[model samples]
Target: MIANKSLSRLMAHVTPGRLLSLGFVLVALTGAQAQETAAPPPLAGGSQDEIKQFCTNIADAARDQRYLLQKQDLDKLQTEVNDRITVLEKRKTEYEDWLKKRNDFMKQAEAGLVDIYKTMKADSAAPQLQETNPILAAAIIMKLPAKQSGLIMAEMDPKKAGVIAAIMASAADPLTSKDPS
Candidate 1:
């Protein structure tokens, strides 16, 4: 019978050496699968820096890959090159959107700065009023637009502007701020 012949053939190949080799191979394959399922190492760079570096590297790799194309391979390379360009374009658009948002926030901040400058200008222009607080003067100097601050420094007496400038400068520098005694 076919079954009796098949059993005889299977028994003929079941040597002790072959069985051990098969078992070793099975264990090795399982070990390899376990390694494959293990988590990848964490990235060394932080988020923003990592994104920037990844984009730069992708652009560079694409450039390098393009240069390796032959005249006969032009069509194949063209598709690849186009795909790279599309990716770069998307990254550029995302960066532009972020920049626009940042600019909008800055614009709002600058407008508020202008309002504060206007009030300070009016108060400082008055005849009899005197601002006694150095902190108030420092705040006023700090709020002035950078160009306006430069112009005011040029227009006013150097000694008075210098004092206010020193206070504002101190307030700006985190390292220079006063420590509690």
Candidate 2:
């Protein structure tokens, strides 16, 4: 109240225009100070940019993690597939090697029988054939000419001769045997 009375006394001495201008200037300064101190209004939406940015960051992290997980799964699957293929390939190679050895053994056995039949006389070979494996003896007799094989078969025991004759007959065909009729 005292300050207002002092301002009124000072204004009374001043011209009307100057006093009005001073009052306007004071009002403008007070408004400027109020604006400077006042806080800005809050947004209508949730929290604002900070929360949105945090959500975006979280989403990005989730996406990156998902991609990494997929890559890890794919890598594991690929390794398993490669391992299976390698195992199958190795097994195939071993099987092929076994087949080659079996074929080599069969060829050598056949060649040995052929040599034995060719070197020995029918009487000697027939006695030996009767002593050895029936299947092996039949195979040797089959390598000889029909006449020679007949002589050897005649010398063998009847049951053994029948077995050899049966094997020889089964082995013969139009493609492999000469006309005996």
Candidate 3:
């Protein structure tokens, strides 16, 4: 009760907009904490293969995301966002067809990740990769086609692009330090 009184007093001094913002932050933090604390569902005793299949399906879905992005025009920038969504639909259809024909869904998923990596390397090297800012440079490095890294670097400010490019190039290496965040 005393704690509540202090908190209410503190909140009272905050502007209405600030109070609402704090409320939103508090809600988000509490929700995330609850999710982290929630117990996992009990696993079925004999569903190992089924679990593998489920994971395979999810990875395959992820591959379609990359494929669809690849087909969309990145040069048009703003207009291409709409086209990318359409490409994603096409990729989904292709993934579904593959899943039906081949029982080895897991292999397909692994191959898709490799394909995405190659695509990113190529796109980032492309001469036309968007050179808007360090943030966009980082974003493009993830989805750019293989061989476009050089192009992104050429278009960007030397210092900022160089640092990000080095990070991109070394991502294949094992992590040397834990993520601070």
Best by lDDT: 2
Please provide TM-scores, in order, for all candidate models, with all chains considered together. Answer: 0.31, 0.43, 0.23
TM-score of 2: 0.43
Kindly report which residue stretches of model 3 are placed more than 4 angstroms away from their true locations once superposed: 1-136, 176-181
Q: Give the count of colliding residue pairs in each prediction.
A: 0, 0, 19
Model 1 residue 109 CA deviation in Å? 0.8
| Winner by lDDT between candidate 2 and candidate 1 | 2
**Rank ordering of all candidates by TM-score, starting from the highest:** 2, 1, 3
lDDT, candidate 1, 1-181, per-residue tens: 9999998998799899988988999999999999988967666658669889889999998877777666439878888999999999999999989888987986686577557565555434321112335555556445666765565555555666677778788787889746532
Q: Which residue runs does candidate 1 get wrong by more than 4 Å?
A: 1-72, 121-151, 155-181
Better TM-score candidate (1, 2): 2
lDDT of 3 by residue, 1-181 (tens): 9999999999789999998999999999999989878967668866878989899999999999887887564546757776898899999999878866664764475466445545554434433333344444454565545455555466656677676776665654576454422
Per-residue alpha-carbon lDDT of model 2 for 53-170, expressed as tens digits? Answer: 8999999999999999999999999999999999999999999899889879977988888887877777887888988887778887777787888888888889888887777777
| Model 3: how far residue 151 lies from native, Å | 1.4
